[model samples]
Target chain A: MPYSVVGIGTSWGGLAAMRKLLSDLPADFSLPVVVVQHRGKDSDQLLTELLQDATDLTVCEVEDKDPLMPGRVHVAPANYHILIEAGHLSLTIEEPVRFSRPSIDVMLSSAADTYGKGAIGVVLTGANEDGARGLADIVKLGGRALVQDPRTAEIPIMPDAAVKAVPSAEVLPLEALAPRLVALSHEREKAGARRAV
Target chain B: MAVPVAAVPSTGAEPDRQSFKPDLERIEIELLLEGIFRHYGFDFRAYAYASIRRRLWKRIEEEGLSSVSALQERVLHDPEMMEKLLLDLSINVTSMFRDPGFYQTFREHVVPLLRTYPFIRLWHAGCSTGEEVYSMAILLREEGLYDRSRIYATDINEVVLQRAKAGIFPLERMQEYTDNYMRAGGKRSFSEYYTAKYGGALFDQSLTKNVVFSQHNLVTDRSFSEFNVILCRNVLIYFDKTLQSKVHGLFYDSLAMFGVLGLGSKETLRFMAHEECYQQIAPPEKIFRKVR
Candidate 1:
């Protein structure tokens, strides 16, 4: 798991908000992005294609055993959770946690468990507080956390929820999220490479 | 699949959120869920609020709204938005023979009891997209019970129902699922169950010969048919205590005397209403047989 996971949690106007972060990152971005957004099991997921068109990165709906790769973004495939184990995605049809299958917490926590310090957990906009505990899990596992600016988010409860749990997360606006993710990715890469060396 | 009855915790302690304060925001969340249930007839009010909070928080920032109140307003006015939120709200992640060992135990222990009955009915409650139902069908077929059993697979979300009917998964995944299928004691080549094309594996339609896919909500819908075996793995964890009890009672009523029940690894019959009612047949697999 050289350049591993960047877990993003968002809701509300998340499609547009996420595009802001994805478009800024080059297609060659060397980390896999897995996102969990609160959505209906029936809603059309154009985000994979939309993000593909919006950004230079490879975008695709995640499959049951989709291997994690750098420069690729895996959207939790509508209602399925995107989880990582032994460096592979394992989706389950388990009951919704925090009312979502692609639960932000499940994905973040799994990423922390799988990648540990190599992971970056990012919380974006939403009306509820789903990712708070997830962000905490990431931090506890030694992964860095970044929360979207509550004032700038489409919905602020999400960021506020996360902040309440862990006040030290780097809270930034949607505009600055990609830079922060990229910087975190670069630093994690060096650490990972050094460990390998 | 019929989730095995967890040992009903005698206390059925209020959903373990004591450490985390449930502020006015929490109450508002309850209200929002209640509103959704009342207006749309999808009963999410009794679902684990922790799961709801997790998903909604992300939507809040992405939607650029400040509160659940604002989110509530939009959800009420916009059917499409509400639909989107519903997709986000209901957990739909599932696969065939997920946790193969559990299915292995079902084949070894539960299938034997089912043999005594001339005909068997198995319900996969909260079936999501029907993967487990097909998994059951495959298992029953191998055990020589497919022709005698009628499997009803139900879920609240229809979107996943269509996908479940299609039975197409990434060909890339069949390797593992096939391995799981074999490890679970498949009688034939796992590939014998499906055809591979376009980088996807299309499972056999015949395996669904006895499976009836339908829509039923675990929260709002009542148990309609009596079943010989119920596999409700991983669904009840999303429910709050009261709702879990309601569901457990439904399962208790739905099951035939000495019927079999299967649940997820993390879920159990401990401290549930039916804790003493169903004796554990296999603890590791969470398989229970009704004793009373």
Candidate 2:
């Protein structure tokens, strides 16, 4: 099946990385995108606004039960774990995983389980090893896993971990990621269009 | 502009592979939650597994235990350990007027209906630490409804309930709370509501004169009375789908006709059995009114 959603995880240097990647998403990006960027407990709506300024896509801070819709970018709120259900998003105050509430692993694994082969997990720039296991889960579930080429990353630790964890993951540079995802999303939309016919 | 950094070759230390056995960890977690429920009656078995496992491991690591079973053994026998674990499980993050927009909507839309009632009973369920309950109290007072309203703020943990009753918050947070209050449409200077004392800001006692702080576990306890409004924000997210539906049913049963039901900013009634029974009073605020 064509992927229905994209799950991205990053920390540390994620803000700039996200800005570059999200800015590249076309306004009609077909798949819903969910992001878990580790942030401080008191971080305000500044991140969402910043990402919004970068992308044509509607950037929103994920609220509980927010619908998974195409063309919208949902960013997990700080200090809460965002779980992806079948067609909606849920937030949890349950303890942070690996000292990170918006743990990349939690979001990736949940998205992997929820979307299975129709999920794409992307591991971007970060300092910690949070998204590696989640990317592994995505790969194990027959989903695509992508990692930013560690050498190209502002913070390489995160993508490096992901690369080691999921050998099959496409390790591409940051600039190459947006085009790759855009192509994947376009393929899925074509598949969806074909199904409709 | 976002800085474009060149990609470096993968040269970091090898990833920290998961050391524990997944099947074993699952068994141990199930056993621990079951043990905790059987021995202490604090049921966490219905909580979502992934998060619960993370929390259990956190407690285990904190206690320097090697496994969930080991943590379970100590918690079952040690009251202090049990208390600590209880804090881990029940302690939720909340703030006064946390989502000012919700409070703003409440003041504008829900207040008029509350004004119509001769006497009002508001239930603040899972009111962890009571910042939100106090916010509601202040709002009621501003609307001139405090004189005839009684706010029952309950939580699963007594530790937070006591803290809520004291009405003392850290001095540093006052600035944030003041901003939230103003955004929520406060009628007067936010500083007028509290005085700094003992390095904390002590809210006016009169604000809570009609407020009752108590311990009530939503998981196992029955609703005590029908309420005009039941505000249980940010608490249900910790529960599994089964428990969330169960609690929603309880709220539905406990609400009087046309009563208000306010949830956390991120929560919704879309998936609940009683979803159609209520009307969304405030869009995107999670405020619903029982219409059936």
Candidate 3:
């Protein structure tokens, strides 16, 4: 399947894991990656700067109605829920679900709703189980679901819960996720080329 | 712009033919919005489509209706359903001193400018539930400018306006609000401003002595007055680009020279028609001074 977007959810130990995954991806990555990393309400743009340093892909904090483009990494801003729409993102200051403002579930579920089979959900290391249900939603919507192997995670609880929710999800070690995504992108490109012919 | 409708899993039917379901749903939503504007005069037609679509679907699900057209049938015929949908649409998720950093920056930057004027006029556009309005009042009081400040707090929904006028907030939220107040540089105990009554935090009435609460639709209403500062944080995110530009024009016309315009943290004046007219006063905060 040709994946259009990637929705990644993580909390505790997310920054280092994100850095590792993002740094390993090629500069010409073919999908827009939306990330929801649990952070303090007043966290600054330092996350964006740090993530940008790790990858050649352009990374920035999402604003309301910001467009989604290939090779861009859009980080959910602090103190808001990020919802996915067709070709764009929307931010809301609604009550935080499960004590998280930029709730991983909200982003991933919206991705599932908008992108359907084109959505890819990735659940990574975190202290909480926020991404479990969202990954389930993605799978239910005929989308792909991936979970970082709990044994390889810094904090395994999140990935473990995700595995429990979607047992059929592709479980990969942290080191292997970037390569898998790159391989998926190449497959998507080949699919697009086939359609063109 | 074509608002892509979310794809529903196709049943044992022609998958390509089922693609038109989203288009039909989109048309239903547009017709519903248009019907609402013509019949009720609430111009939500230009709201950010995705957010509005989510809200409409929420209302639909809550009402146990099957589709947008079904919800529209009820809303048009029944004023009560329309009222409920209005609440859902205009209910902004707001809190006292939301993004406390913005208030801290206001104290450091905007307060000094307000000191120059003998009397200050402030406008809290889309002041849902009045938390930010009262927060501003307390901030002004702490800064010794509350006596000189006149605030006009307005919203598109009258129900929220009434709630704002009451000055009662959930007592359970006080702990959170208190934390926000401290971070916003509160001078006194946050509890001193409110007393527990009616199972809620009934704030001191004096905090709103100069405040005028009214129903004013940002999408349709005209500018009422000039002001020293205008705050419409996180409110315009619901609007589409055209509506955002139009409301920005309204704010531009309403502000006096050098008046400050404060937006939500994520919002920016970039790409705005009046972008070059104002200078950003704070480095990262969305506070701007109308230079032109």
Could you tally the backbone clashes for each prediction? 73, 7, 0
**Best candidate according to lDDT:** 3
Query: Which digits, one per residue and each the tens of the lDDT, describe model 3 over residues A1-197?
Result: 66778899999999999999999999877678999999998788999999999999989899887777677899999888898877778888877888998999989988776777677899999999999988998888787898999999999999999999999999999999999998877776676667666
Tens digit per residue, CA lDDT, model 2, B188-252: 99999999997899999998899988888898999899999999988888787779999999999
Candidate 1 — what's its lDDT? 0.76
By summed lDDT, which 10 consecutive residues of candidate 1 chain B come out lowest?
Answer: B4-13
Question: Would you list the C-alpha lDDT of every candidate in the order shown?
Answer: 0.76, 0.84, 0.88
**Residue-level lDDT tens digits of model 1 in A2-47:** 3357889898878888888899997557676887877776344466
For model 1, what TM-score is found for chain B? 0.89
B269 Cα displacement, candidate 1 (Å): 1.2
Measured on C-alpha atoms, candidate 3 has an lDDT of 0.88
TM-scores for all predictions: 0.60, 0.77, 0.91
Quick one: RMSD of model 2?
8.0
- TM-score winner, 2 or 3: 3
Lowest-lDDT window of 10 residues in candidate 2 chain B? B4-13
Q: Residue A171 in model 1: shift from native, Å?
A: 21
